[model samples]
Target: MDLRQLSPTLAVSPQILPDEVPALAAAGFKVLVNNRPDEEIGAEIDHEVMAQAAASAGMGYHYLPFHPGQVTPQLITDFIAATTGRGPVIAYCRSGHRCTVLWALSQAGKRPEPEILEVAAGAGYDLTPVRPLIASLASRRG
Candidate 1:
């Protein structure tokens, strides 16, 4: 798992295996957020397996799957709530792109644009495509 710590309380990674649950728990992540739907990854390691692993490891699990480029505001709001609760958290999706994008969106109103962009960039995610949206969201909040 290539876990990238975006903030002290938030991290994002590519799809994690059931066996990786222990390491995740040991690393101080109290929550596991799955951003990929089973259909995208097949049933190989479905949410049930991941959820069981998370449960056994004593970490909370949340499934907020969204298609690529189809993230909704409700999803962002849910992500924000989950990430802010009992974290540090590790959210995952295929290659972690959607998770990173959602993280950036969720932080739109609460954080500065420069800080959000810098953090996303540091994590190997470019937010230029959604920068305008982020700015708009921030302005609405302001």
Candidate 2:
């Protein structure tokens, strides 16, 4: 998969399959966060399959389906808690958009505006549309 590093702790990629787990493990990603809803994709890439694969590979897994306008504080909290101490986390969705949004929100206060923007851009995710929200999140941390 084409995985892009958003930070030392986080990476983003398109939807990943069971076969890709070895490569992910080899790449040093200790956690796999699935942001795609199961129904959106076919059965092949459902949460259960990915979760089994991740578990088999001895990696931590979290299924946090991020539907547009459905991402809540609880989801973010769960995502953060699941990713905590899980170094080199990799989050994936259809086009990596959901994963990008989750990562941005997760970094709300821990990272600066410019740094967050730069990191998102570097990962090929343009956060211009959500700049205001990002700014608000960053300010909240201050």
Q: What is the C-alpha RMSD of each candidate to the true structure, in Å?
A: 1.0, 1.3
lDDT of 1 by residue, 24-130 (tens): 99988899999999988767688988999999999999999978778888999899888995969999988888898888888888999999999999999988898
Instruction: Quote the RMSD, in angstroms, for model 2.
Output: 1.3
Per-residue lDDT of candidate 2, residues 1-142 (tens digit): 8899887788889989999997899878899999889978988879999999999998999999988768787888888887778688998989887788878888888887778778888889898877787778778777
Instruction: State which candidate has the highest TM-score.
Output: 1
Residue 71 Cα positional deviation in candidate 1, in Å, after optimal superposition: 1.0
Range of the 10 consecutive residues with the lowest summed lDDT in candidate 2? 133-142
TM-score of each: 0.95, 0.93
